[model samples]
Target: MSIQDIVFVTGNANKLKEVKMILSSESSKFNLINEPLDLEEIQDVDLKSIAMAKCKQASEILGPNRPVFVEDTALVFDEFNGLPGAYIKWFVKSMGLAKIVQMLDSFDNKDAKAITTIVYADGKGEFHVFQGITEGTIVSSRGPTTFGWDSIFQPKESTNGQTYAEMAKEDKNLISQRGRAFAQLKTFLAAESM
Candidate 1:
């Protein structure tokens, strides 16, 4: 196949769907594809560093001089002092969202933020990073969606007052951290294509 306009390296179907939706809404001639590539993530507190490292590693492994992008996300809780932060995956695996909300129940402050960083490396290895952050608080897990940390997150800026898991997919795309990041990416790609 011809080189895709961009290839997003990720395993999460939810993310892929959100990004595709964002890109398609542009009505621009840009192609985006996702192929899950597991890479050893460098331990870091910075989401940008991790995303850049993954993008670099993925491009190196793929080795065809194509535009490749990868993203990393962190859910930061003020009560835990951002304890999990970039290490959220392991934290989620061990404690799950229920435990996180439960642990926060005793605290007076429940302020939290969700961050997503996307690093894109061109065939020449030049990288550009886009980030999105949503300020929210932890809520009791609700909804049927299984994506990590969604059910427990209640974004403060949303007018619907629903957790990410509870909103329709398009609604989530409008306000999600990943959605915002991809929105920026879409703009960047459009400008670059000109």
Candidate 2:
């Protein structure tokens, strides 16, 4: 597992940048390079399952002799009982941030968590899933800096009550779900290398 580079099946440059940044900040001897595969998202309430599908597909397409990784994110709402849990991406695309906030107007319990599942698959076809969850509450979209549902999600770890979108990018890195998951992935990679 002393990999110098990995095939990350993603087309999103932002994701690639974040992963690259995370790895660069660490002392580990691994670099995440993009493969740019448009893997289909499978239906599952479990984020891990979705990630596993992506990983498996990426591994299969790239052959089973190489190391690759894929990530899936899900936004779970407490009051909605996770109605739009795994479909948060679709919701964001179809309904936009305003509708998401407005949907919770009547619900007092606005508690929510952003869950990021990062699945690493080597040539062995074994899936290693690292998850990161950040507790936060739904708030009105306040900033135009971040993308997706970030503007309406105020992470509990935020000191200034700013939503993830409102906080500085580097600051969000300290507490964001994707940040934490990749951090765990870093530790896992290091441990496996040993």
On residues 1-194, what C-alpha lDDT tens digit does candidate 2 reach at each position?
Answer: 45466788888777777778766755456666678987888887878888998899999899887889998778999987766887987999898898988998898899999988999986676778899999999898888824778889999999989998788878888899999999998888777677
Residue-level lDDT of model 1, residues 1-194, one tens digit each, is 23256788989887787678877866455577777998889988778888888988888888848888998989988877765788877877898878878878789998899999999887775889999999998888888647888888899987878899888878888888988888898888767766
- Candidate 1 segments exceeding 4 Å error: 1-4, 26-28
Output the number of the lDDT-best candidate. Answer: 2
Candidate 2 local lDDT, residue 4: 65
Which residue pairs show collisions in model 1? none
Cα-based lDDT at residue 149, candidate 1: 84
